[model samples]
Target: MRLVRGALRAWRDSFDCGGRSVAMWFPGHMAKGLRQMKGKLQKVDCLVEVHDARIPFSGRNPVFQEALGVRPHLLLLNKMDLADLKEKSRILEQLKQEGLKNVIFTDCEREENIKEVVPLITELVSSNQRYQRAENVEYCIMVIGVPNVGKSSLINALRRLHLKKGKASQVGGEPGITKAVLTKIQVSERPVMYLIDTPGVLSPRIGSVETGLKLALCGTIRDYLVGEDVMADYLLYNLNKHQLFKYVERYGLDAPCDDIESVLKRVALKLGKTRKVKVLTGTGDVNVIAPDYNAAGYEFVRTFRKGELGKVMLD
Candidate 1:
């Protein structure tokens, strides 16, 4: 309640570029009074839907489609840094199939990557709103995304990249950063578009075991939802039949088979000596076991990310 109010006040006090309207969009789980904010999106001329490149489907806002109801949207795939290049390509194709024509993959931390989307965003807004000299378009552009997926980072990068600093005030998130803000950036390229950056959202579906791990890796879910051993077990199970099982074989483990549990136990045993103890250590000295479970867990993630398990998308 308080965060939302504070954000609304900040936007109201900010200077207006034209007859434009902007507002922050956030997850339903983040705060109270959001239920009343529903149907408010109907007023926006264009929607800027932000999603993670890694798990696009899981990172999407469940209420977005319902709220917008045929409104035009520009889907921004943020955080290209952590995404698998192959998976990122596939996800973009999938989104096009899902009816999003305006899409841009960006790592807003770098200005070069950020500028590539300027022409695309400009074209989308111009086409959707169609501002003419005779009459003003009076635009409203809303930015929506899952929490901690770099929504604020994108907005901040936008201001800095465009050299419109000292003009916008963005709120900071609790236990995170940047709770909410809706600001206008004077884009000489895209004069008709009024930008609205909303608070990040963490949909409830992301609480699932696999999706949660993905979000945790993305820094969206901060708490230790899964321990090192549990995560390693998950990776082992998921990657048992993975396409790049050859990598495991390269490490001298047996070729992975259909039975995932067997593969994990084998991995545990194989790394036992590295951890300075036996997999089933009792009386044996602790200096001769495989890699510790925690270390093994990191290796699993590292290998998985490096395509050791093959082309996999945790969608």
Candidate 2:
């Protein structure tokens, strides 16, 4: 997509999260998942952390580094299809500077770049010290990541590639799809490899509201928790900031817009997302048809998530 350059109008420099606390967004189930993963750390040979490629620089749970970072790790940035990869090399370089040398971009749904996963895992484990597992020939890997980043999809993709098998884990579009640490599912046959799938967990204390919003935008967190209205606004802000104007054409707008309510109103009117509501007048009550802004906001956010508005780099 060719973005228009030159004198663009002003956009939001920052977003107001309405004083919503990060603690409210962190659910109890995620805490339990983290504890369960820690207990099974000793049995695993390598940690494959899957994350959304769009927000590569932010929204990662620090607990993964503090608790599970000791093992040989590979950071797999999933959902490559929805991310802007023009800056992929730069992103990798920044991650390398932070001591993360092993990284791969993958689209689990299409199973793109999945052929390289097994070999990469083998190389990482072989180069690192195996310790007590030196006598064991089979390899066991633990898949970890923030919520809804496609942990289960990656496992299923590997299984389809190596074992010629069907899904061993459940896949969904929302966060917290895998509720617990599941039993190991074999993905490769020749070298005898198995992967343990864990529920997506987030940090109990997120650093900032923007990080939380980014995670929410990527479906790492529940949409209602951050509010659909605010998320739609933030999405618009990022789209304009990056000069991604596909939304203007998609929603049938005459020009680019910064006001989320105005955009959503247009979307609601065009899509016929309206509801009849009773409003009291000075004389009597009358039913009036009004645009469902919530529904419109949801569709706007959904379109962006599906990459209909064009690829975005939220970091």
lDDT by candidate, in order shown: 0.55, 0.89
In model 1, the runs with Cα more than 4 Å from the true position are 1-29, 33-43, 87-89, 129-139, 164-176, 181-192, 205-208, 226-229, 235-313
Q: Which prediction has the highest TM-score against the true structure?
A: 2
TM-scores, each model vs. reference: 0.60, 0.93
Each model's number of backbone clashes? 25, 0
Q: Model 1's lDDT to the true fold?
A: 0.55
Clashes of 1: 25
Best by lDDT: 2
lDDT of 2 by residue, 229-248 (tens): 88899999999888898988
In candidate 2, stretches whose alpha carbon ends up further than 4 angstroms from where it belongs are 1-8, 18-20, 130-136
